[model samples]
Target chain A: MEERQRVRRPGGRAARVGAAVHQAVTDLISERGYGKFTVGDVAARAGVADSSVYRRWGNLEALLTDVALTRLNARSPMPDTGSLAGDLHTYAANVAREITGPEGLALLRLAVALSGNGQQGRRALDDLLAERARHLQSMLDRAGERGERAPDALEVLDHVMAPMYIRVLFGLDPLTPEYVDGLVDRLL
Target chain B: MEERQRVRRPGGRAARVGAAVHQAVTDLISERGYGKFTVGDVAARAGVADSSVYRRWGNLEALLTDVALTRLNARSPMPDTGSLAGDLHTYAANVAREITGPEGLALLRLAVALSGNGQQGRRALDDLLAERARHLQSMLDRAGERGERAPDALEVLDHVMAPMYIRVLFGLDPLTPEYVDGLVDRLL
Candidate 1:
């Protein structure tokens, strides 16, 4: 029936299942924190069979990685506002919202927890980071083509993203719009 | 008996027990990660009585907080090298080593794990950050008193400390001397 659903509706049922499972994962991370819940818990929460989750994601770590990547990437979307400053402002503001949003801390904590577990977890962390880096590099490259002096990808990570993540993780002050913009100004 | 030993040797027996317990906590965090072990586990690993652990720390969270604050503060002494440039270089280099050290990752992971747990965890996290901010502020104050320009304590944190910490948490690149020094240089 599950295979038939995938075949019949393609994006319709499969995407719904995927979204349900991802939401379940995020909710679990928020309530139970990392390493406390399991695939069965997620399956039960999502109202999907355990076998379906395993068949689709293979394991909890993969499901978590998928959730983080899909949600974070979908939330931020790369900005190309025709100027480097505008691009950075939009990009940094998007990140601030994503990290401070209802599901943001859960995903960030999931990434941190996954990174230290073992080989599989390490791979998941690497994939999430690589994807973000690639996304940001494309933006930087566009700036270069437009003859705008853009900082390196790592610089953006260090100056902008790193501060915001650290603040969120440590439960510090809010990532105000001015504060986020200040980071961009300093980098430029 | 513990009281007698404290009276007889002053800091001798008390200090030894504290060190042993803290080492055990670090080792357990390294091996088993956070929230898996308890006061009993720490006591057994340290070769001290559970009562002793409880008496000193009051509970597991308190013990963990003490370990984090004591070790982190000791490892990264605020450098006052008579120049802001010299002070920042030394300070950043010291932090680079502390986070990348053997026991460093465990303590850091513990902090991240604890911050999301509950009220006690939040307090522990706040204590750690406050101590760090206090230490850094002293260094910046010294620089200012010496008739040198100094960035805000938060700026050093945003620029120098945040990047190193985020990198460590995500298992990113090594904090090479050039990279650490560059953070200070840019801040200046």
Candidate 2:
């Protein structure tokens, strides 16, 4: 109650601090994987006092979950790239790039680690996947309207998206433009 | 170094202890998710001292990775079900079963958590996925031998296996036997 009132009081400074902290979380995750970070690390990176983070999000996993939500929001409402394939290719590329990158890789690790814990982490993961599915489905629907080919949204996600993730997450194969293109062609 | 010497000097007590520790790891991971576990928990569960686990595996992550390797070994080398569809159905069932089960889910979460930290955990995950791909490839090869249709190993993984995992992991859909059959029919 007190925290909510403080944020709503004025200037939106609390909001800015929240944003900075989240951004710092992203940068840190991107730079190093999630295993090595601490709340103090996040606080120092965000230029906020350690107590400010404790006062706000209360803990590391919660803060990280909040950060993941923001990242999801920033990435979502998938762009209309004309065709489902185009949207998928664009979308997959973004995901591929993020996971393969140092920061994104860290964030993904944290997500997996979180998956083993409580409902909050698992829900975040499920929601993230479902949200992407919704956006991807919109593009497929658009493709159908255009009289182009379209598969079930889930089918495309499973066939294309799952393998892409398996490969990227495991380093089983290079997540290349060629690989993404191939996934698009085969699925479509 | 001393521990290795101690194991070598024994009447295979080391082997028994090792197996017990690994089993305890699996049981705990299955009962709860990996997040709630520690070397101490594993030690107690195994009826071994914490120092035993510490001396053998050195850290929680290392122990977890070793446990993952064992699970992968136990799960792989799927039977020759005479058709790619049959083989995949059998194989995917094993995976779906594991992921849905507490043990498998915990292992997966661990793999994802490790994905960001070091190459060791990531490599274990990669090897596990690749091992499954190889077994799936054997079925594809057999299909080719019979002049039956076959896709590339990676494609098979992406289309057949990927969709199965996406559903099982995300709960986007049910992982019924009928569902696996449907996935096989579509991909094949």
Candidate 3:
């Protein structure tokens, strides 16, 4: 489904270049792991000059962060389903699908690796999570205003949204739609 | 509170050695990041032979994993407040306190750096999260049995437990007790 969506999305030259670079990085990370791969390898795979890659991203971590952010942004936004349960189910399913997918897992694996180092890596991960959380929070707030969710909409955001990443990134059990639905029904 | 609890748990020579080595690695990683640190540094700091560190944990990643897991286990268990809201509030507060603390942030930063690289690093992180989640799940299950929580306990776990980590790890707003209480009231 995500593959189909990516295929359908319009891509311009810069977007294409970004996509190519990001894909190259992803392929390398998935195949060789982070420690073994280098910016030079990324440059070669993307068919771009090392200088260009460095000029755009400054470092390997920054380049990976850009790729992660781009991939994260490409995910489907939360939907309004009238009821809290309905909205939560939609949100959970979307998250479950993404996290369970190859790209999401790859990013998660990358994030966990990068999270342990310095402030730059930490900030990059924090920014990615915050972006997603803010989006989910906005949708949740709408649900609250419409009387589909509780006054404290962030509760659903925390409980419903955070676990998918935890499970997927940590390589725990696969997050199924049923598991998400059950969570939404009880929590919301 | 964690300081008090650490004093209570006593162990043998191997456990002591592991603790020493773990602390050494953590300190090194905190100061120098994983990319620049090595087994020799960990050994020298721990006052153990270099081969001993390698024999016990294989690589720096494995050594760090042991350190993280041991430190995590040393924290106080969640209090059973007999209400889902109360339990969640306490849990969130505890998590908030940990994540905001110097050591917690340091570990999180380290995990991010290590997560980008190897399968071992990823698994190590997953183990850490799973250990914590299991603890939360046990508490939630107890709440459910007491009729203080929803029938579907995992929902409460996701909504209540997951978000606390999200906010702290991302370094967003401080996760206050009031926020946790609000979340619990709405979701539980």
Candidate 4:
């Protein structure tokens, strides 16, 4: 499902170059987890010059941060199923499906790793996490529009997201619909 | 903080060799992260014969699994304050401390990566995750003793644990005591 959806496009020749490089970044990341790719590898794979890649993004870490930030901006279509709980369940199920797959888990594990990098890397990761949090907040706000009370919304968000991630990244259990429903029911 | 405490002692002769090799495993894992260590490295670092290390653990994955399981057995001292929420609160704070540190995060990331391994590798990680779940369940059971009603405790457990791990592993935010206090208060 995720494979069919490419990174959302930006305009112009520079955007074309950016899209090409980002595509190479995603492919290499999925093919070989984090810590294995280099700027030269991304350049060669994207058919862009190594100098162009380096001139554009400084180093491998910067390129990864750029790709991650760009990917966040092209965010996946979020669930909006009337109630906050319903939306979160849909979101959890989607997360479970993604994490259990190689590509999704690889990107996430890579995110966790990059989150630990020094300064600029940390800021990039912060933006990425905040992007996800915003989706949760929006879902709850929609619930509020429907007249449901969702005070302490952030804590509720934690209950919804944390478990799905733990399952996806840890493989403790199958992310069955039953499990996600149980979580949504309990938290709500 | 973790550097101050080694995996607790198990027993004699074979135990001595096991301790040395496990120590080597921890050090190499911290320094190089995953997929970068070898049996030969462990053997040389632990001053054991390479043949001995191979005979006992067979391969790197198996060795990692063994080391991780042994570390699990020497689990952290459980938080046992009178109230269920109080104990969970303490537990969450301790978890925040452990996970934010380099050594703890390295081991956990390694576990997540290894959980994707085939058969024996998966089983080892499964056992490791189950062991932690058992600790949480035990805490809930004790809460039951105090007559605190936590229906569907596994989901409740997720509410308790998921956010902390997500924050620590993803660097989403600081795992402050106040943050943990919020989780406990919201859930209980």
Candidate 5:
């Protein structure tokens, strides 16, 4: 079995500083956007020294990426249901709630804007997406192993999850619980 | 019956000028990025007056948005193979090809980056997404009408299409035609 790597959660002074800096960065991005916000603004907003912000995150892109990841991790985990359909419904609802939330939408908008610029920005966006995909894949894998789903379950799982992001990211429509349930029924 | 929208094909001096300006903007965004590129730079690159560029597009955001939309429309239309499986395979393959292609990847990277910023930028990103979704939805809707798909065909379509975009946009993994086939088989 491949061992899952553990990520370090912020702790001690680093945690406190990270929390403050992240909150500041989020506020700045929401207020002025990535185009207008700067490391100096983040430092001023957080009431920390400029060097302190730079020492921790290295650059504006790195700082915002970290903040986005930290906020994501703080959210509730995907629920475990005996059935794949039940689990998917719960998962989709959770995702819909998060994506539609104020902070989530703001951060998402920022990531989308920054994703096309530089190598660092691209990697940051890719990393966040990979993390989420892995989580969804793991859940589907477990369902398959339990004989609750077919051997090639990722395809079905992807079909279910993809539309939610499409609806939200594309602004074509809203992702509602009804939509999620409809997807779960057809897919699983 | 709803009237079908005709695809605009650029011709004549004014149309050619617009195309040239759009190409320049795309090149600039790919090379220098949206954040760094300006209307003046685009006009200079296209060999057009700055006022001309502004007159054509109200602002830089509007210009880039229109350019992105035009490029997307110019791509070959999705094939109609009369079979959902075959059509999906073609569609997914096309998406994978574009997402992995040099220009496609560049544009995708740009779209992702800009997704999170100012209202104008966010709306632009949304419009690009809606065009693609509408394309997919139309295909799926046709299948449903023909009694060749499930009652909830859109959900089925979403399941198949979403993963490919998720993989490409998020850089989770490369999408293969085989995977697309598998998705179609399972979903259908």
Candidate 6:
């Protein structure tokens, strides 16, 4: 009886619902693009009550922000290959896979759209950037501790992250292993 | 009589209408964002008949492509200050200003949104990229002629243009003169 009760905990159910809603939001944005769907649509797709989404996220923008932040957090953790160069290469490759993955472009577009969308949206974008920056900083900090002269976080952002993102967004070229390594090499 | 006839020529009126329509489209995109407005809305804002827009551009995506291409062509001509470094610095500064300008973010978001939309949108994005690439190639060619070992156009795009675009799109730090120069210096 106790085992069954633990399995049916309220927190577990809530988490399952949250995952479903996030997935639904991603799928909708991928298929239909941003600003075309409503909270009700998301709820319908996730098979949850509309009020549940509203109670949790407050509004569509908040919900979108949550989805973006959650996805960023869920991406592969920052690498620790014992050398700055190896770590950067692995980190860049992970990012390349995520952004070029099936739902990557949609999330990227969501971030861009949110930034331009007035106050709340801009705040959401800032939060998203802050999270990514935090992860990058930790990696850089580790390099610093190892007595390696690591480039600043901004350098990695400007040189490595920015190019990969722009290329994917524009469909310019494949983010091949050679190309990803080339960015890390240049930055180093 | 001849001057009046020239002023009132049909082609002159058509050009005026095109300008108004383009401005209307840009303004709408800036204010409301992509996919939020319609052809009728654009025509109403531009003070033209709906049929007029349809006859000229055929669809919203085409109209958007035209706006992006036209704006790219209308930017300041490629600078030839007798050196690749000078040319890249000036060019990066110009891009920084344009992308940070009042209408810049909206246009960029439009480009991103269009790229993910479908086949037509992908083609439109390709056209925009090709136009920009042509201008970049000309500047590189000039440097080659001067016996300066110029970096290829892709190098410039990857190092300079990509960083600026990604920065502006995410509302990151301002594209300061120093920052723009740093990208050029690194590329050279």
Report lDDT per candidate. Answer: 0.87, 0.73, 0.69, 0.74, 0.69, 0.87
Best by TM-score: 6
Residues B94-151 of candidate 3 have per-residue lDDT tens digits of: 7667666657766655655445546777777767666766777788788778866453
TM-scores, all candidates, are: 0.89, 0.85, 0.73, 0.72, 0.77, 0.91
> What value does DockQ give for candidate 4?
0.43
Which lDDT tens digits does candidate 2 get at residues B18-54?
A: 8899889888876776555688999998899999999
Displacement of residue A42 (Cα, Å) in model 1 is 2.7
Which candidate has the highest DockQ of all?
6
List model 1 lDDT by residue over A112-180, tens digit each.
Answer: 877776788788789889989999999999999999999999999999999999999988999999899
Clashes of each: 0, 3, 19, 0, 16, 0
Candidate 4 regions with alpha-carbon error over 4 angstroms: A1-32, A35-60, A78-100, A134-148, B1-17, B35-56, B77-94, B118-120, B138-153
Ranking by lDDT: 6, 1, 4, 2, 3, 5
Interface RMSD of each: 1.2, 3.0, 4.0, 2.4, 3.7, 1.0
Worst 10 residues of 6 chain A by lDDT: A1-10
For candidate 3, give the DockQ. Answer: 0.31
DockQ of 5: 0.33
| Cα error of candidate 6 at position B188, Å | 0.9
CA displacement after TM-score superposition, residue A187 of candidate 5 (Å)? 3.5
**Candidate 5 runs further than 4 Å off:** A1-16, A31-36, A81-86, A110-119, A122-153, B1-13, B76-88, B109-153
Q: What's the CA error at residue A138 for candidate 1, in Å? A: 1.0
Using Cα atoms, each model's DockQ against the true complex is 0.69, 0.50, 0.31, 0.43, 0.33, 0.71
Q: Candidate 4 on B64-154: residue-level lDDT in tens?
A: 9988777655645578898887787787777667666777777777776666566776799888877877887788889898898853556
User: Per-residue lDDT for B73-166 in model 5, tens only?
Assistant: 6663777888766777787677667767557765765665556546876887777766766777778777777777532545544766567666
Please give the lDDT score for candidate 1.
0.87
lDDT tens per residue, model 1, B80-185: 7888899899999988998896589887887888788779888878987898899889888998898988899999989999999999999999889999999989
Model 6: per-residue Cα lDDT at residue A89 = 96
Provide the lDDT at A144 for model 2.
90
Flag the better candidate by TM-score, 3 or 5: 5
